[model samples]
Target: MESDYQSLFQVRLANYDDIPAIMNITREAFVKYQQMSGVEKLAALEESYNDVKKDIDTKVVLLALSDGEPVGSVRVEVFPDKTAYLSRFAVKVTSQNNGIGKSIMNLVDKIMVKKGVTQIQLHTGSKITSLIRFYYGRGFYIDSTDKSRGYVRALLIKEYQKKDC
Candidate 1:
């Protein structure tokens, strides 16, 4: 029996072989955002296929596939503070607005909840307010702003608390 959203597509742990597809999506989505932000430092956030492959050992990469085609990807890393760092979430531009991003985020939220995480955190350039709003829609709130970094960005955190059982 498949979950309602399963649709013959599985969201599961990514492997080394998925790096190329993951990087392609990442570069395509973030490259232009980098250029338009007047922040050359955005170049530093890029992850090549090799770099993404290395992350497999330290982070959880979840890939969303439809009919065996890679359509989206997300990464979550748990810190010593028991908080999960969610980043590098990307979906093919053509696949936007189809709930792919939401599905990936939901999957990560469940995993973190099971792991006993108290919160999740992510950072994005302040200019990307839409992305921040997206997070907010997902129940996250801006925790602070860090102008001391390469570019003015907001640090957002989402607390995860189990509902009354």
Candidate 2:
């Protein structure tokens, strides 16, 4: 099943024209987070086109497409210390459980590795067990937790092994 999906799915760096698709997917995906965390408003849900465009200009923004249509998206910014911060990762609700999220993440790892990023970090609601498990399965581990957002948000980190080549 995963392989079948992979054949039809493609991940690519996003461009200016992709802002609309990215925004749509983010809203569709993060609404679930807002509901699960009981947060009435989220930064992801409030982003405007300019905000996404700025991200596209400064960060690594990617879109996951299935048969030429956008279904998922993610953004990551790599810092001077070779650490990257991932944000706005989302797969459409209709496309969940189809291996799209995992595929996007796997591509993220490969892209970061090529960029010499030693670690990648992201935060999510601690109570989202399924999401936590998904991160764990993708080689991420909890580094800490913070309640500054009125709910526990777990900081997860994934470290890449430097190739000896």
Candidate 3:
């Protein structure tokens, strides 16, 4: 029988108490990318618990849980121009490849739409082939790149357009 991840995982907005787990998961998730890119100082890996709490206070920090343990998380910070900056996306190293990241992205997209956002954007290490493929598969295209910026990341963007009948 196939596993029903929706039934197995709980998705919810994070609280201050969840910051430590969030930080740990984010750090662990980015370690592979760091190793791949030779960028040890990636901001995601250096995020402090307080920094996460600030995000919880200001933006959206969504988490997927398994029996109350945080397994995946992503942050969405909305801007004034109908754009949502999606960042700090991370899934537990052990919980990856199990559709957890997709679940989080789908949920976050819905959340953004409900918040009146028309565009979603994020940055990922350009050297990570899997990430580039995943983002492309999700309908995001490489909007631009600033190699001089942190870690030579790619700025990907996805726009939601309302259908006209």
Q: Largest lDDT belongs to which candidate?
A: 2
Tens-place lDDT per residue, model 2, 1-165, is 676656777999999999999999999899998999987668999999999999999999999999889999999999999999999999999999889999999989999999999999999999999999999999999999998888899999999999987
**Global fold similarity of model 1 (TM-score):** 0.86
On a 0 to 1 TM-score scale, where does candidate 3 land against the true structure? 0.90
Task: Give per-residue CA lDDT, model 1, range 1-165, as digits (tens).
Answer: 455566766678899888888887777667755765557765426556677877887898999887788888888899888888887887777877777888888999989988889999988777786677788889989888887666777888999987789
> How many collisions per candidate?
0, 0, 0
Model 2 scores a C-alpha lDDT of 0.94
lDDT of candidate 3 over 120-146, digit per residue (tens): 999888889989998898889998887
* CA RMSD per model (angstroms): 2.9, 3.0, 2.8
After TM-score superposition, what is the CA distance of residue 45 in candidate 1 from its true location, in Å? 5.7
RMSD of 3: 2.8
- Model 3 misses residue 79 by how many Å? 1.0
Clashing residue pairs found in predicted model 3: none
Q: Which candidate achieves the best TM-score against the true structure?
A: 2
- lDDT against the true structure, per candidate, is 0.80, 0.94, 0.86
